[model samples]
Target: MIREAIEAFASRSPSRFAILVFAAIIALFTILLSLPAASADGTATNFPDAFFTATSMVCVAGLTTVDMATHWSPLGNAFVFLATQIGALGVLTLASILGAIIAGRLGLRARLMAASDTNPLRLHAGPVAEGQAIRLGEIGGLLATVAISALVIEVGVAIAVLPSVLATGYGLAESLWYSIFYSAMAFTNTGVTPNVEGLTPFAHDYWFLLMLMFGVTLGSIGFPVLYALSRNFRRRAKWSLHVKLTIVAWSALWILGTIAFLLLEQSNGATFRNMNPGEQVFQSGFMSTMARSGGFALIPTSELDSASLFLTDMLMFIGGGSASTAGGIKVTTIAVLLLAAFAEARGRSSIEIFQRRIPGDVLRLAVSVLLWGAVTVALATIVLLTMTDAPFEFVLFDVISGFGTVGLSTGVTANLPDPGVYLMALVMFMGRVGTVTLAAALAVTQKGQLFTRPEERPIVG
Candidate 1:
């Protein structure tokens, strides 16, 4: 009966399952965290703080109303780590894995839901195999591969960082633990640090920062890209245009952001004044990469120059790739939009990339995602500005950070009023699922036009 109900509910719509899965995880964590045992002093965590923390962790946003180090007990931290892992893996993917494990099979509706929840864009790009049910063995195999690959990457990163952590004067056991925690946090792009100073001590440590940067980049580059690269390594398979576009866009954005940060913050006494040239370059690169939904910061976000902050806001909005742990409008969406603009500027009728023409629907969807994201952030900025006396820049930064799931803040998160916290929480939720998916989830039902209307043109800008 329980399984039947789940199947029925999942059949209703993919968004329902995705939303419910995240909702369940958040609720469970919220209850667990609200217990007195979850706190350091044995005092119960208030509902507001618990809810906000739980939402942030489950969404992998990493924003905190209270410090994890000072306020939360070991048990609470464990809960947060688990929730972050779940969020990073994705609610739908994890849920499907669990279902496959327990039932030894996934129903047709379950597979469809899993696919839709993880990559709805794929469904749009291709047709589902007609009258063919997805095999349970196939899903189980894929799930196993993804899970083992992720574990291996994370564990390898931990081992690599362990020595550097010990060099910092941390005790052996503590260093080992911290290395593992940092590896997990980096790969998940949660940006939450168990360390009190939040990675500040190792800002100039080459090995530590490099390893973390690699981990963050690998995780946020999207799993599909990784899988494709892996397959190509073994079989020399042809690369899809999607894979090419993602890599190109990701690399371009990282380079552009790094240069922008370096130029903007070169003379900012608070951040880059004392740093040596090499250290500044590394820090600038790290910040550039992290700003695009990785969430780690070497320099204090508050100390960044206005230009650097504004540039960061744009990077955070563009975000990482689709179907990855990272959030924002996604690299592919930005790439598509840019391609469209370039095509229009060249007086071309179709947007062509790598000799492939982008479908009209795909372009439309990309525009919708970008527009919706902008509107959401704008509205959030207005709300935060009206509710608090915080600076406009800080409020705007916080809003975009939440919506990007990047977790970088300008020191305003902890002081936000209750209403503001809740508002940010909502933004985090939407971001985790994605602006497009959230829009789909809120839709009443899927409907298509039965007849075409005559096309008309409106006045141009």
Candidate 2:
């Protein structure tokens, strides 16, 4: 009976089904984390902390109320690792993958649902272009790419960082565990360090940080981009417009962020002031990369200048690519919006990028995502501000961090009251699943009108 009900729901709305699955997973992990075996001291954790940690893990948000390395038992760490891997697969994609595995093939409904994850326009009533992202017929291949690429990349990163872990004076077994944990966290963009010192030990280890940056970049680029690049690594001309735009926008943001950090934080003694020129550039690059959903922090976020914090907030809010493990409104949304603005400025009737025209629907969708994300962040920030006496900058930083699932906090998240904690968890969930998905889930149906209303223009801004 339960299976029947689930099938009914899945058929009705993939967005809601995905939300339900994520909520269920978070709940299960919360219960597991609350158990005595999940803690280091053999005592059951409190409800608030356990629930928040579980939500962070399942959302891949990485914000924690408790000390991650010292508070969790080996068993608890195992649970977290598993939860992050699941979270990285994404809710809808995971469901479709599981269904395909069980049935030995993806059904029509399953394919449609999974395709929606890649191209959200598929969720609404519309005719989505076959060349947009992943086609419905290619859903099986996309799922395979998602699973296989994640495994290969994580394993490769783990092997590359294993030597570094061993150099830290840990035994082979413990080193192996830490390497795998860090690899998983890096590739998933979860940023939850397995050690209490976090990235302190590896702050100067260029090789270790580079490997993590590589893993995080791959993870944040979105599975669709990976799938496309794998098939057309040498054939740039064959790349789809979506792939082109995502790559271009992502690279631009990374470069701009690096420059911004370099200029803004160079004089700040706590972060970049003491570093030599070369090291400063490298660390700035790392910080820029991490700001866009990588989440690992070498420097103290609380010590950053207000200007740098605000810049980091923007980077975190933009987050990573669409349909990626990373969060926020997505780079593509911003890219589309930017392209639309440029088109408007040029008095072009249509938005074009990479020599391909973008339909109005895509622009509308991008605007909707940006607005919804901004609203979500603003609302969360307001509620959090009211909940705590923390400074506005710190509150805003943590709120955007939660909303982006970027996990770089100004030490404010750990001190949030229970109400704020719950609110942040909800923000994380919304961020992970996406505002579009949530909106679609709430919507009853998309009504199609056969006739159009008379055109009217209101007063312009």
Candidate 3:
């Protein structure tokens, strides 16, 4: 009956179909997480807590309803591992496995139509010769690369950290399991770990934190950039146009983010009192980059000045890049928006970047996506602030973190009161599913005929 229902639903609108599949995955996760395998006493699990975990897992947002280490048994931890994998792969991508098979049997033309409908931009490019093949290869190759890269790093970390674990004189089994889970969480940016301290024991250490941060940076750079990098290095080819734009935008955002946070927080006694100038700079830059993607914290995030909070939020909103593990509006979207704003200021008709004019359709997409992101953030902030008595800055920080899929927090999420949880959950949902998908689902396509009308501008800015 469920299969019949799915088939029936898929026959209608595929976007809705995609949503339904995601819902099923959410249900699966909820059931697994809600299991009461932990033998700990004086603790009880509730629907809200489990449901919240399910949402966080499926979204890959890393916000938690329970202390993961204490609340979950080994089996429960294992479930979390699988949940992260599913969440990282994304329901849409996994759903495509089935969708593609069906579409293929339906014929290449039908498959192309389905693919084109799913991603509207592909259709606008004058129908490339091997569009479907390219899309399929890109999507599959990207996820496979992420999975493989994550495992490689995680295994390496496991081996390197094993000596430390062995020095503790514990059995190898416990150490091995903890190492595996910790590496997976860190690399995937899930932020949930078997360790109670959650990366604090290695806090001041250089290599340990660097490895986690590096994994996260790679994860957040988006699959498109990764694929481009791979092809460039492998084939000895020049970097593609997309790769250049992504690299430039990503570097600029982080450099500015690090500098902005350093200036904002250094003078503040709460954040920089104990650290020397060099340590302050290192901590600030590391914190800034990690906040954009990785959740690991070397210093206390709660004590940062208001300016630091605002800067972090801005970085989170811009996020990493599309098809990357990170969320937010993404680097390219913000880049396009920045150029658009510049063009408007210069009284230009179209936005241009890197001396190349952005096509009208691309500009429209950027504007549409950015509008939704702004509105969503505004709504989330308003709703979040109204319900909770927590400081507005803290809530805003977490909101951005949740939306960016960056797991770093200001310690505000642990005991979210009432509507705050719901608001953050919605923001995470938007971050995970993406504003583009939401916009496309609701966007109305208009038809232009032979009849035309003259336009007159009404007001000046």
Candidate number with greatest lDDT: 2
- What pairs collide in candidate 2? none
The deviation in Å at residue 62 for candidate 2 is: 0.7
How would you encode candidate 1's per-residue C-alpha lDDT over 1-461 as one tens digit per residue? 88666766655655656687888889999999999999999999998899999999888887899998779888988898888888887656665655555456776545654554435553343234321112233444445545766788789999999988888888998888789888888888888888787787786678888888888898888766666676565553366666778889999999999888888888889988888888788888999989988888877888899888899999999888776778888898999999999999999999998877887777898899999899999999998888888889988998999999998999888898899889999999988877776677688876777999999999987
Question: Which residue pairs in candidate 1 have backbone atoms (N, alpha carbon, C) closer than 3 angstroms, thus clashing?
Answer: none
Q: Highest TM-score: give the candidate number.
A: 2
Identify the runs in model 3 with alpha carbons over 4 angstroms from their true place: 1-12, 38-44, 101-140, 160-171, 234-237, 344-350, 442-453
Give the per-residue lDDT digits (tens) of candidate 2, residues 1-461. 76566667787887888888889899999999999999999999999999999999989999999999999999999999999999999877977766555556678878877888888898885337658688887888898899899999999999999998888888999899999999999989999999877888788789999999999999998999999999999999988888888899999999999999999998898888888999989988999999999889998899999999999999999999887889888899999988888988999999887778889888898999999999999999998998888899999999999999998999889999999999999999999998988999999987878998999999987
Q: Which stretches of candidate 2 lie over 4 Å from their true place?
A: 101-104
- Candidate that beats the other on lDDT, 1 or 2, i.e. the better one: 2
lDDT by candidate, in order shown: 0.80, 0.90, 0.68
TM-score order, best first, reads 2, 1, 3
Q: What is the Cα-based TM-score of model 3? A: 0.86
Model 2 deviation from the true structure expressed as Cα RMSD, one decimal place: 1.2
What lDDT does candidate 3 reach at residue 284?
75
